[model samples]
Target: MSRVRNGLIGRGLIPVWLLLPIVALFAVGYVLPLSQLVLKSLQSEGSWSLKSYLEIAHSPTFFWIVLRTLTLAATVTLICLLVAYPLAYMIARCSPRVASLMLLVVTLPYLTSVLIRTYGWIVLLGPSGPINKTLLQLGVISEPLQMVFNAAGVYIGMVQVQLPLMVFPLYAALARVNPSLTKAAQSLGSPPTDAFLRVTLPASMPGLVSGCTLVFLSCLGFYITPELLGGPDDYLIAQGISLRVLILGNFSDAAAQSSLLLLAVIMIFLVFRRRIAEELDDSSRFDDISPLGATASGLAARRPIVERASLLSHHVGLRIHEALTSVRRPLLRFFAGLALLLLTLPFAVVIPLAFSDAPYLTFPPPGYSLRWFSRLFSNTQWLDALSFSLRWAGLSALLSVAVGVPAAFALVRHRFPGRLAIYLLLISPLIVPHVVMAVSLFFALAGTSLIGSPLAFALGYAIIGAPYAVVVTIAGLKRFDRTLERAATSLGANQITILRTVTLPLLLPTLASAAIFAFIVGFDDVVFGLFLSGPNATPLPMRMWDNIRLEISPQIAVVAVMFLAVLAILGLLRLFVGAAIEGRRSQAKT
Candidate 1:
């Protein structure tokens, strides 16, 4: 038996057993269902045909739904971009401490489930809620506005929910901008506005493109917000697909709709990508600027080929430059503050309302007490679901780390076939919508024994969370020196020994980050939990979903506040660990 195992291991087949759970998941959760959906789309009344797709194309309601979804997505993307750009820029420009705090605010909502966040939106946007109540008190309007159950409500909820997705990418892009460029621009007699437009904006275009692409793509497949907040006329393609599958019991129609949305999304991204690539390529073709046009008067070559500063900047005296330009930096700062406030207010709103003495959801309560929070602890249903979610998160995080660590190792340490393709495939989940995955997985698991099982949910979440683990671990591993591993090997260390001492120690910080990210991905997921959860295994987000749908409850606010508190604690821990790792690395170098 030992020899047989060794032979299999030597043949690269031993690890196959370790992959059984993941392989079963990918095959049963993704491949089979997608295949079935495609096959179903092909079948007609009795035989294979394009009839289902044709029927969809021919329907006026289908076209309207498609148009509505696109419009809603575009509107939300634009609004999010408008709101996120300045905030991201402000955060990136601030001191490290301030930047870290700002980043925490932007990312804190990410730890809480989207279902809870959307419910917060519901409380804020409802007629009797804060916005309308304030407006009525001020006599801005005698009657309440029709904000909820309309496109307006959907836009607010979706944009607020999805803004972080846009902000982070743009922040990353903006963060990459060199401060020297801005200084050089100032020294060259180019005003800050001109400098920003001519230099900063062009450099940051990649981030904007990336952020917009990510936000728009995600918005395209949104289901819950639109369904919960919007009126019947506000239906998007995702809602249409759900209606077809769940209500109408027409799997073929749902498949066709999903396929169309997928195709259109791919086409749209491809077109935008080509346009940006062409633009960049065209910019690269431009020759050196004329002496007359050179804003930088001095061009000094630090390295042989690349100039250290622009031509005009080289001429401007490095010191004793003119007064530094500061544009309505304050105005921009104020707007950034307002945007952050708007993004986070729903969460803030929940805290105060959670303690309301009245059963009704009211702010500035007649009396405040901890009774509701006390009630939360005694609510067995809520407690069970929360416990279930925590367990699922822990399990999923472990599984994600398991799959991700190896993949990260392989990608960083080895050269293999299809490496880039595999990397893209693994991270592709981040770009795709949750509802699509939920629908696909729903169909895939319909007849399988794995359906409605905790193991199945864990596997499902592992896939969703795997990319985050990969991102964090790869970042950590990339920054790590491979020479340490080589030295260990040379000292007669085995693979396990080298990994235990050299690799694992260096990768600890990253591992922690990956673990946190994996837990967040699983804990915050709503669509998957909604689709895959059984009575015994229903995650907190799904339970919250049931509560919100069945009736409006204030206990959700209590839950939301607690969720945020846990996230804050986790985030702080991650920061401290990261700092300690950095300190150790610095000390070692010293």
Candidate 2:
């Protein structure tokens, strides 16, 4: 039996079974739909043609919307980089305690729903919101200015939604910068300003490029923020495509538009992917090919006054640097403080607003009550939507783990034909924009009479959620020690026994966290929910999207707060599980 098992394993038949689930999910949920989408885009009058593409190309509306999306995405990327760079730099420079505190502040907004974050802007910029009301009270303006439902609101919401994305990559880049290089520049008589630009800034470029690419791509497909907060004439590409599908029932036109956007995403990623992969794949690249020494030398030579004065006075050269450092540190703190406030204040304001009895959105409520929470439980539609979201979360958690765990195992424990291709295919859902994926899946599901089916939505959610699950599981597997498994095998245990008794228990903590993350990813989904969900299976996010659009209501605030609560609970659960796992690991080591 042992010989047969070893032979099967040696032949790689076990890995084939291990990978079967993910492959099947990929083929049915992703590949088939994308293929159908391409076919749909090419079909014209029941015959193959580029008529849809030509029509979309010629349409003024399409052109403006595409231009708006590109412009907005680029602007948001730039703004997020500018705002987050200082914060990231400050965090990187700070002591570990301070840095950890700052990171917690930065990460808080991420834990909250993106829908809720957009709602935060609505509360701030509304006619009856705090900013306008305060201004009116102070006689700064006689009439409330229209801040919501405009380009300003969309920009604010999108920037806030995408800010954390930019900050993390930049922080990683900045934190990894060799301090010795900067010190060497200072020693060589280069001013702090020149050293930063020539040495430190260039070193941080990888993060800037990665963050900008990610934020821009995400901004293009964003639907909830723009749809909820944007004005009638402030249409973007995703909005335009959705309107075409929802209003005119024109899947072909929407597909063509989506395909165009997809092509752009592919093109942009091709331009930057090499840099991203280079930095990620080879951590030692910076150490091997550091430009800091070269940059500092050039800049030091360029500064004649500083070079000449180095003999006259060591302190004289540092005069500019001292003054600059003294002022710059405070300015960094002040702006970072403001940015943190901007991140945290909205959530703080909204939590109380949910408890308010006010009829409309107001900062200082007329009164307080639990009516909204009651309504959340009482309203059949709300309950139904919440129920479906919970169901979606559970099934997606299961499905993601089902595929993700084995995929992680295969990728980590084995190397075989098409390994890299398989890995790329598994993560390809992330490569395309969500709106494009939604448009493609929507049409593909329609052809099979599964457009509004809950099962179809679950599969769609699994595709998106699995990538994250795989990532989390892979991270844990990399940290796992295989010695325990070998010990179990030497004790006469079979492959199944070794895996079941040793591997599975050790991986449980990471699996649990991955499952919770997968749940949240499915639960808060709006774009796919918008395209695939309907009257029968209205996910909570889709319902929230509807509520915000058809009418602004307090119930949405209730839902948002509920989202935060669920995430908080899940976060605590994961922490507790982590502690337990650590305890057991310690016992095993002893």
In model 2, the number of clashes is 0
Tens digits of per-residue lDDT, candidate 1, 228-270, equal 8889878788877777776788887887777776666656665
Q: Give every collision pair in model 1.
A: 296-311, 296-312, 296-313, 297-311, 297-312, 298-311, 298-314, 298-315
Question: Ten consecutive residues with minimal summed lDDT in candidate 2?
Answer: 276-285
85-183, model 2: which lDDT tens digit per residue?
989998888999999889978877875777778877888888888889889999999999988899988888888888988888899888978777777
Residue 32 of model 2 has an lDDT of 84
Error of 2 at 169 (Å): 1.5
Highest-TM-score candidate: 2
How much does candidate 1 score in TM-score? 0.85
lDDT of the structure predicted as candidate 1? 0.74
Cα deviation at 231, candidate 2, in Å, is 1.2
Question: Ten-residue segment with the worst summed lDDT in candidate 1?
Answer: 297-306
